[model samples]
Target: MADLPNCPICTMPDPLLAADGYECATCGHEWLAAPDDGLDDIRDANGNLLADGDAVSIIKDLKTDGKAGGIKVGTKIKSIRLVPGDHEIEARVDGRQLLIRAAFVKKA
Candidate 1:
């Protein structure tokens, strides 16, 4: 339905409206619309809903610019900005701006 929004957790386009809230078929996470803005919650890897300025940590070592020295596991990334794409996480690491996949990080 046009009125119903996409699931914030899995980004599923269609979610069923239950008595309590909207239930996502993809991830099965139920969410209620925010009373103020009507936007659903966006969850991080740890099932914690993420917001701007939230701190997250890398789950694994990630290569950058084809370098052998990559971002280490458990690297703490701060003040992350959540974009529209499922894996898009914009943040600055070591004074360099980069885009990190959401699946590789957890809320810190």
Candidate 2:
């Protein structure tokens, strides 16, 4: 199949697949991977650093009067994705997974 195939790692030229990942022929460094669409970072309510796409717990009980209402403390959120904002995470809890400001939710 003749096509413009760039290195999966560096998005540059493709090398002979070394061990697992593709190595950049020019840089001499192996590029690891591309993050998944769901892969992202999230912070906790106390403002602590959390991992990208992690399950976190709500330390403080949250009261929402919107479409999705009320998340209690110690609630666990799964597959939380981080975005760039004052509130960094997009997550779901209870009946609705919603965008949560990282300053509000902490890493479980």
Candidate 3:
């Protein structure tokens, strides 16, 4: 069979394939070879790669269109969907679907 993909965490070559996905032998970290949606790599403020369903926190106060008081600093946002763009995070907060910049958030 073809070689398995490298581990995302430790960068170890060839994690073994399993029913769920691949698991790193060195770090024991398990991750899928690619996301189901086929979106490109998504990174956070600290440059940590983000995956779908990742929870992130707003690092600074961000003004939204309708909200009189904008989103507060340290607001926890869950289930973020990464899209393809400069400001490329899709999330729902306070009943509003918002497109947030990755620079303003860190993995929660």
Candidate 4:
């Protein structure tokens, strides 16, 4: 048997292959498998590719809602974690966890 990919919606590993596409048994989700084209590459503001544990610096000052202060430009962040979703970078700032968009940071 051929190896099947995990469901994109639920992350289930046992999606069954169907005539049209793959179907997730756990979540009842169906999706067509596309070729892996490196579309998920996360790039910084300087167009540098970012990876987990890579250090980065904020390129722009960002405001925090209901917070006393905001992230300043050139603030350094170490050991960044890459996460899925709109905000791709996750790091700790000022003792608080923050989800930052990759566009606001640059490789440091």
What candidate 3 gets wrong by more than 4 Å, as runs, is 1-38
lDDT of 1 at 57: 94
Q: Per-residue lDDT tens digits of candidate 3, residues 1-108?
A: 886788888898968887878988889998876656546677888998998899999998999987699899999999998887777899998888999998899998
Screening candidate 4 with a backbone cut-off below 3 angstroms (N, C-alpha, C), the clashing residue pairs are none
Candidate 4 yields a Cα-based lDDT of 0.90
TM-score of 2: 0.52
By TM-score rank, best first, the candidates go 4, 3, 1, 2
Model 1 segments more than 4 A misplaced: 1-41, 66-68
Q: Give residue 58's error in model 3 in angstroms.
A: 0.5
Worst 10 residues of 1 by lDDT: 33-42
lDDT of 4 by residue, 35-68 (tens): 5544379999989999999999999999987687
As for TM-score, the candidate ahead, 2 or 4, is: 4
Top of the candidates by TM-score: 4
- Native-vs-model 2 lDDT? 0.67
Q: List the residue pairs that clash in candidate 1.
A: none
Best by lDDT, which number? Answer: 4
List TM-scores for all candidates, in order.
0.57, 0.52, 0.62, 0.64
Compared with the true structure, all predictions reach lDDT values of 0.81, 0.67, 0.87, 0.90
Off by over 4 Å in 4: 1-39
lDDT for each residue of candidate 1 in 1-108, tens digit (9 for 90 to 100): 358878997887888888867898878889886455322576767788778898999998899995458899999998998766555688999878888877788999
Better of 1 and 4 by TM-score: 4
